[model samples]
Structures are given as C-alpha cells and as structure tokens.
Target: MNPLIRPRRLRTTPAMRRLVAETRIHPAQLILPLFVREGLTAPAPIEAMPGVVQHSLDSLKAATADAAAAGIGGVMLFGIPSTRDAIGSAATDADGILNRATRAVAAEVGDALVVQTDLCLDEFTDHGHCGVLDARGLVDNDATLERYRDMAVAQAEAGSALLGLSGMMDGQVAAVRDALDAAGRTDTAILAYAAKYASAFYGPFREAVDSQLTGDRRTYQQDPANRIEGLREAGLDEAEGADVLMVKPAMSYLDVLADVAATAQVPVWAYQVSGEYAMIEAAARNGWIDRDRAIRESVTGILRAGAGAVLTYWALELAAEGRV
Candidate 1:
C-alpha cells in the first residue's frame, strides 16, 4: 500500500470527506425546469413523468415563487401550447404559452432568481420537430435559424434573462444573438445546447411537453458517439457569443460535459433531462433504491463532473428538502 496516496484516509470520516471534497453542489447551482400547459385551469400530471405536472398560469406563478424562496438558482420554463402549427407560430408569438410563462416566472421571481425559457419549438410544432420542415418534410436548418431569431426577441420581451437554445440547429446561437442585439436586448444571455445528443433519455421530456415528434432528432442533434464533435460544437457556440454551453442528458454524458466544461471559456451546464429523472423515480417507487440518497448522489455526480449548473426537475424539491 502507498502510505502517501491513502485516499481512504480522507474518506474515513464524513467531515474529512467534506473538507477534502473537490466539488460542491448547492441549491443555487440547480435550476428547475417547469412545464406550463396552456388552457389548463388546474395542474395536469404528466403520466410518464411521475410526480411532475404541467402547471396552469396560476400554478406556475406559485411554483416559481416557491423555487425562489427555496434558494434555487432559477426556473427553465417549457410551454405546452393549446395549438400547434407547421411553422410553430406560437413559439414566436408574444402571447404564446412559453413567453407568457416566462413573464409569469419573471414577475414572481424578478431579480431574485435568473429566469430562463426554452427557446425550442418541439412543444409547439404540429410535426414535433425542433424546427420547421421543408417541402420534403426534412428539417431546414437555415429556416429554423430565422424562426429562432423571432423566438429570441419574443422571449426577451417576456422578461427571460436567459434563453436556452435547445434546438441543436446550425447557426442558431449566432442568429439569435444577432437578433437580440438588433432588438436592443444586449443584456439577454444565450445558453447554447452545444453538445445536445439525440438520446432515448428524452422520452419522458416528449411526454412532459406533449410532443408530436414523428421521427428521431438525429438530423439536428449531435450523435452520441462523437466526443470531438461535441467540443467542436461548444467552440462554435463560444465563438458565436453564447454565455453558457450545455451538454444534454447529463448522467449518460458526464464525460462530454466535463470535456465541454474544460474546453469552453463560458460556463458549462448539464441537463439532467426528463428520462434521467424518471428512471430515478421509477426505481425508487419499485423499492430498488433509496429515493433521497439517489437524488443527492445523482446531482452530486453532475456537479462533480464539472458542470457549472444543472437543469433538473428535482431542483425545487432538493432545495425544499435541503438535500443540496
């Protein structure tokens, strides 16, 4: 045994492990992702995502207030529109559910928490694509960027401090940034989903958003196999003025998260996406795991992987329970 490299010595006691911990998870380092469905007078439970609900306007306000009170960093809002269209018009409409939800959260939390909104169209589009399709029914990348410009302005006007560009479209961050600047919203920040991969872990998210995705997102989202490509995407986003770079499905891609965090100058974030959350909940319900311990460990793993912050459904609960 190497006496000088005795890692067990540090792990021998709880206080010793805490003192030697290289990473720390705090309530302020977690951002809650909430879904608000339009025309819902009461909260609706997402069947696939147990314990999560699609909030109405009033419920959303109360939830945001509670999140702020619990010392969580922020809320990332997603909207389930009352109607869907080919072009996802609702995503760019000022009165759209997402933008309106942003305003609601902003009004409730104000400057107390950083309010962010999902700047993607999957939840609002009839085809359930992140972008509008062309004549051939394929996602048109350039066309999507144009739509993103409109979306950025709408979200900014709705009082979203940060826009989470989760569409994985080419030139999206730069296009949105230019549009925001042109609209005199230079203060608004862009959080690029720089290394988002097309993963099965997003199944629960589709349920949460009432998505109508007919096919896979492989055309736009990154492939799970390529680490170098993830770095390339993060670099492009950074050059395009993204304030933050994110790796999606954090648990399965911690290596990618760490790689992006190491390479990017901007803050790197990770999304503990819906499927990840559901897995934990499902296992806990089946009595296969200790729920609280699993939640803490999952979040702790994300923080230890070099994420600057994590977007999780458990944000408010974690804060309320003082687990973070």
Candidate 2:
C-alpha cells in the first residue's frame, strides 16, 4: 500500500532540505548597528547586551574594518556624546562623537560598504526625548523637524551614505530630504524608521546608549498594538522620499514587517532590536537553547516574513561563522 501524500519526501535529507529552503540569509543582507562613545580610551562593554560594547573612536575604526571584511552590506553608527542639552545640540555638531565616528568609519570602509548614521536626538538630548520639548514639557513635533533638518546635513557632511531617521516624528522624512538636497548632499539616502514601536524591547538599548530618559516615548513612538498604522507610516515616509523603510523590534512585529514589505515601492528592512538579542543570548547561556540554530532561525524567520535586509547585532558573529 502506498500513501498518496508523503510530505516527508522533502525533508528526507540535509541536502534535500537545503535545496528546498525558501529563505536564505546572506552577509550582504545584514547591517550591523554599532555604538561609539565620546572620549573613551577603550571600549566600554554594555552590560544588558552581552558582548556588545560602546567603542572608542579607534576601536570603532577597527570594528568597522572587520565588518567590511565580513562582507556585510553596511554599518549603522550611534554616538554617545559627552554632553547633551534640551535641543540635542551635540547631534548636529560636526566634531561630535557620532560625526567623528562617521568620518573615521567612512574613511576606513566607505569604499567597501555603506556607512550609515543614526539621525535621531534621543541619544543626544538631555531629556532623552527624540525631539525638543515644548515649554509645557511635551515633545514639540514641528520644532523637532527643524532640528532633524540640521542633523541631516551634519550627518551627510560627515560621510554617512544613509541617514537613519529613527525619531518617528511627523514630516521628518520630508524635512531631512529637503535639508540634504539644500546642503547639496543629493547622494545621501534616508532610511526612515517608519514603524518604531513603543515597546519594552527597547530596554537594553537605553543601557547601551546610557539613556537619560525619565519617561516613555508613547507620545511619539507607534503603539505596539497597531499593525495598520505601521503601513500608513511607511507609506508617508515613502512618499516623502525615503530610500528605505524600517520596522523596529523585528520579531514581535513580523506581521507589520510583512505588511510593509508587501506594498512598499522602496526596500523594506527590519531591526532585530537589543531586547531580542539579549533574550536569545540569555536563553542560550542557560543551556535552554542552541545558540547558533536560534540565531539562524530567528533571522531566517525575519527574512521569510519579507524583510529585504535586517539590522542586527549578530551580523559580525554570523558572518564570522559563515552562517550568513
């Protein structure tokens, strides 16, 4: 007697499974997110996210070289300034940590990979809001756009190939685009963080950046419960000249990612945020999960859900292991 349907035929061997795989992860599809702190003689390790560090400028150059050697598509830089103010003055300072880091990394690997910069005020603001606060203590939206314009030009002038606009402010894409063009940085691209959610998954990132936040960003970041809103935000950014759109906290928001990827005119990407990395590392350390398999599976799942590329802390490690 013969069974009419034997689906196991496709799963019979490793070679068969590999040949039938619908999704694959590649080094060129990974973008590494790196942090560099001002005035550090040595790299400072971030406690919440194991194995991730805030690099000194020198160390940042070394690391960026390694990323380029690994064949990753790009590196996204975040700076931790020694000083911050209500308007995040340091963000637009040409000699600020982030800008200096961008220059160094671009010089080191700009010819080999895309050098990107985080274009947000959260890391540079004394209040830790993504934008300036109004007199009544609310984040002023229109006012923030003005600041973003300055930041766009600064980051572009510093040699960032792509400006990651992760502040989630209204009209940010348009403002930044116009700023870049006016500054004659017509080649600088915008990576709009279109659907960054107000989620607990960003907890570890605060530690990484030494965040000065006293309150949640619920007023600006998209609510975690809204999937359709992600699409709407992405659409607005796309129409406003965004070269790429990003959905943050990738794993929990696969539905939003897939939705955005389905119709976006430009490429769609996902950020496997700090909390997701910490969780996997924590579980692996506890012997509850196979670390390598988990990493591969997690990223594969993101790609399967339609992310054209992924920004992950694991990019280097995965590339080193030849897993991507």
Candidate 3:
C-alpha cells in the first residue's frame, strides 16, 4: 500500500464525503405509512409511538394532503375498524374506514402522490391474524387469498393506486393480480411485503393498531433466522407478478433488503416498523444520541443497504426537515 493513497482523504471533510457519497435519500424515495381508525373524533396519539397517530377520517384526508405537499412519493394507509370479526367482513366493504379513507385521500391528492392501502385482515379481524382462521385456529392460506381477492377489488374501487400485500399468504400476488385485472383495474400496482419477518420489533405496531393477537405469527411471517427463506419468498412474489418487493423491520434486516435489492427485478422497499421508530425516539428523549443525525443515519443506512424506497413513520418529519 502506498502511503500517498490514504482513504481518509475523501473523509477529510463533510463536503469531500458528500461529493463521493454512493447513496442518497430523497423525499420521493420515502413512503409514509398512516393509520386511520374508525370512531375517532380526532387524531389519537399512540403512546408507544411518540410522533405517530391514528387519524380519524378527516385527519387522514388532511394527512394525505400534507404528505403530497411534502413531496413524499406515497402513503400506505392501514385501517383500524371499530369492530372486528373472525372473517373481517368490514375489509371488503366499500364503505369501511380503509376504503372510505382511500377514496377521501385519492380525492384530496388527485395523483399528486400515490395513495396505497394495506391489504391485510389483521386490523379488522378480532383474532388479530392476517388471514382467516380454520377449525384448528390456524391461518387458512387459500381462504385468505379469496379474502385478499375481494379486498383487492374493494381497494381498487376505492382508488388505491397501490395495494400493499402484507398478509404473507402464498399465491397472494397472483390471486390479487387476477382479481384486479378481472375487475378492469389493470392500472393498480401491487407492493409485496415479500420478506416480512416474525419479529419482536412489531410490538409497538400492535399497540398502534390496538391488536389483540394472543399467539405469534411464526406460521406466516418469515423467521428472522431464515435469510435464505426471505430470498425465496421474494423470488416467489416476483414470479407471481409483484410490482414491488419489500423487507419489513428494515433496520435489523438490512441484509435481507440488500439481498432482495440485488436479486429483485422490481424496485425493492423496506419498512421501518414501529419499534424501530420508538427505540430511536426513546433514546433521543434520554439524550443517549443525537436525534436528528441518528434519524438520518438510520434511514440513510437503509437506503445505502439498497432499498429503492422506505416506508417509515418518520417520513413526514424527515421530509419537513429535508433529510429524506
């Protein structure tokens, strides 16, 4: 090695490093995930997640408009129903909170930003599972696909530009795609939660949605130990016509995100879930870290790991701060 060829030369200053940075985060590369709860008169703060809120219908509309104004690429909407049942009948109702919110947001934004909806039953189901349960109380994959089919049509009719298939069911992408095409919704896109893991990091999310899941999601969500399985799932989703592939709990699964990005023909996304956001907030509150820099570093790390886009609770704040 030549002494004259020091690598630290590029790291000598912020401007020098900025000039040679390989990855950059942009507002368009951020997707905000919003929770819309039925029966809420106003926005309700999620205590577990400091800055995030469960928005009422009117608040959801305003939030989507703010997201559009912030120049974020999209917003992923998750619905929290007032009542829940075994089959989640509310999910397929056009008048349900999610569908209604979709229509409202779409009307407000009008293609200025992509309006997407979470295509899952967990929030609507009293059992708090992603799929309909069987006699054995296990998730029925094929049965859930049928529900997803109905949900796809419902979301399409409600003006969801992209459907977030997050239930982790087999053949979901194909089933939903066929349903959308059959309904003459060829313009709608699918965002596959291809590598979502069964993670402890989702604890705050359960609180955010008021989930009552008694058991675990190990049967459907990928195990954190199984990196190869994640890639396999991504491949399957891609083969089934997923327009975008995503890895969940992004901070811990940067490896998964990077691998998926490398192999996926479509755009690869990552979800910075609730626990990730809460941890950062908790630390920043105690002054354990620099809040602003930590936030940027956390998201920038995900981007550098190869996510084309990231779904983060911090999207709005980051956009306002011009960090993304």
Candidate 4:
C-alpha cells in the first residue's frame, strides 16, 4: 500500500467530486454583453461571430428582459451610432444610441438587473481611437479623460446603474468619478477596465459594434508583454475609487486576473471577449468540441481563477438551461 492517503478517493463518485469542487459559477455572477445598432429596423448578423447579432432597439429590449429573467447580474450595453465624428459627440448626446439603450434597459429591467453601459468613444468616433488624437496623430490621454467625464454624466442621466469604463486612458477613473460626483450622480458606480490589454481577441467585437476603426488602440491600451504592469494598472484604478476592476480577454489573461483579484480591494471581473466566444462556437460547430460543455468549462475556469463575475455572450443561453 502507498504510504500517503490515496487522492483518488476524492474522485470515487459524483457526489464526492461536487463536495470537493473548489469553484462555483452562478447565474447571478454572469453579465450579458449586448449591442444595439441605432436606426436599424432589424437585427444584423455579425459574420465574424456566429450566432451573435447586432440587435435593433426593440430586440435589445427583449434581450434585456430575458437577461433579467435569467437572474443575470447585469447587462453591458454598447451602441452603434448612426453617425461618427472626431470627438465622438454622440457619446454625450442625450439622444445618443447608447444613452437611449441605457434608458430602455433600465426601464425594462429596473432594479431586477443592474444596467451598465460601455463608456468608450471608439464606437462613436470616426477614427476608431478610444480618445481624441493630438496634432501628432497620437491619442491624447487628457483629452480622452475630458470626454469620459461627459460620457459618465450622460450615462448616469440616462439611468445606468454602472458605467463600464472600457477606454484605457490615464486617470480616466478619477476623472469620471469626479465628474459623476460633481454632477450629483454619486449613485452611479464605475467598473474600470483596469488591466485591459491590446489583444487580437477584439476582432469579433469590432464587427459586433460595426466599428470603423482605421487604426489600432495600442497607443492607449496596455501592451500584452507585461504582467506586472497589469497589477500596477489595477492598483491605480482601485486608488481612483473604481467600484470594480476588470481584465479583458479572460482566458488569455487568467494570470493577470488572479494577480489583480489577489490585491484589489474592490470586486474583480473578467470579460470573456468576442474572440474567445467565437473560437468555441467555431470549434463546436465543426464538431471538434461540445458547445454546452465548452461554455461551462470556459466560464468555470475563469471563476476558478478568482473572477467574482464574468461578462459572457453565453449568459442568457446558459441561464435559460439552468446551467450557469
């Protein structure tokens, strides 16, 4: 006989495995990401992301209702404006697509689910940069902060409970926080994309938002080469009063997510971005993997990596089947 206790005893039965499971994923810990295209009468398919569509306003309402009924923690809304400009003026407009969508979701779901909006300019800007550019064609961080300040106020006014600050601009959280306080929108929380990296995983996202980005966001978004830098960014966002900090492209950056989760005093979340979803869908469609099992395993991995919540496109589907 072996000198040590046999570890295989824990795997003897399904009940024993369940008892020893180290991580759990709940429907309440999942958030659904939705895109609403302005001026569209019907939802449009995003070819890059199979089974996902750019929803019209009416469809968006139905989706939000479904998410709320599924007991999802929240919904993060992104808008595809009918027009674009250098400064992304639509982002702050009261009649802007995102603001309108925010109102719709808030009215549809109310306190049943947290209503969150993507507070980024890329979807609204013609050049597709997260911030306004300077004379030298580089992203101006301070200029972007100013825009974010206004965007924060507009989203809060439109009834968003939380603002997802996806733009990786310097001092963005503090700037937005200050603006929210000044505008008497202290109730609106900020979910900062603190450790967001410049990853290729956003390809599907571009199509989902109908992005017209002419250039990359590397000038502002963090480089993928450094892990320590992720921790530093998370610390900065935490210090600036971020209610929650997030790491984008969850599967690829589980290490960074773990580090951020370990040190951050605030809630830590992970975005299972478009590319990750598309890959699984593609493989499943080709019969290379089990779609349902893949979704659960991927989400479970993120949870085991210490993500308090995950933003996944599969939220509604999983919840509908009671698999979350």
Top candidate (TM-score)? 2
| Per-model TM against the reference | 0.96, 0.99, 0.97, 0.97
**lDDT to native, each model:** 0.91, 0.95, 0.93, 0.92
Q: Please, what are the lDDT tens digits per residue for candidate 1 over residues 1-324? A: 657776688899888988988777788999999999999999999988898999999999998888888998989999999999999999888888888888878888978899999998888899999998999999999998999999999999999999999999989999999999999999999999999999999998888888898879999898899888998999999999999999998998999888888778889999999899999999999999999889889999998988989999988877876454
After superposing candidate 1 on the true structure, give the runs of residues whose Cα lies further than 4 Å from its correct spot: 1-6
Question: Where does model 2 exceed 4 Å of error?
Answer: none
Q: Residue 149 CA error for candidate 2 (Å)?
A: 0.3
Q: With candidate 4 superimposed using the best TM-score fit, by how many Å does residue 4's alpha carbon deviate from the native?
A: 5.2
Clashing pairs in 4: none
The candidate scoring highest on lDDT is: 2
Which candidate would rank higher by lDDT, 1 or 3?
3
Q: Model 4, 155: alpha-carbon shift in Å?
A: 0.4
Cα deviation in Å at residue 26, candidate 2?
0.5
Q: What C-alpha root-mean-square deviation, in Å, does candidate 3 show against the real structure?
A: 1.3
TM-score of 1: 0.96
Off by over 4 Å in 4: 2-4
Output candidate 2 Cα RMSD.
0.9
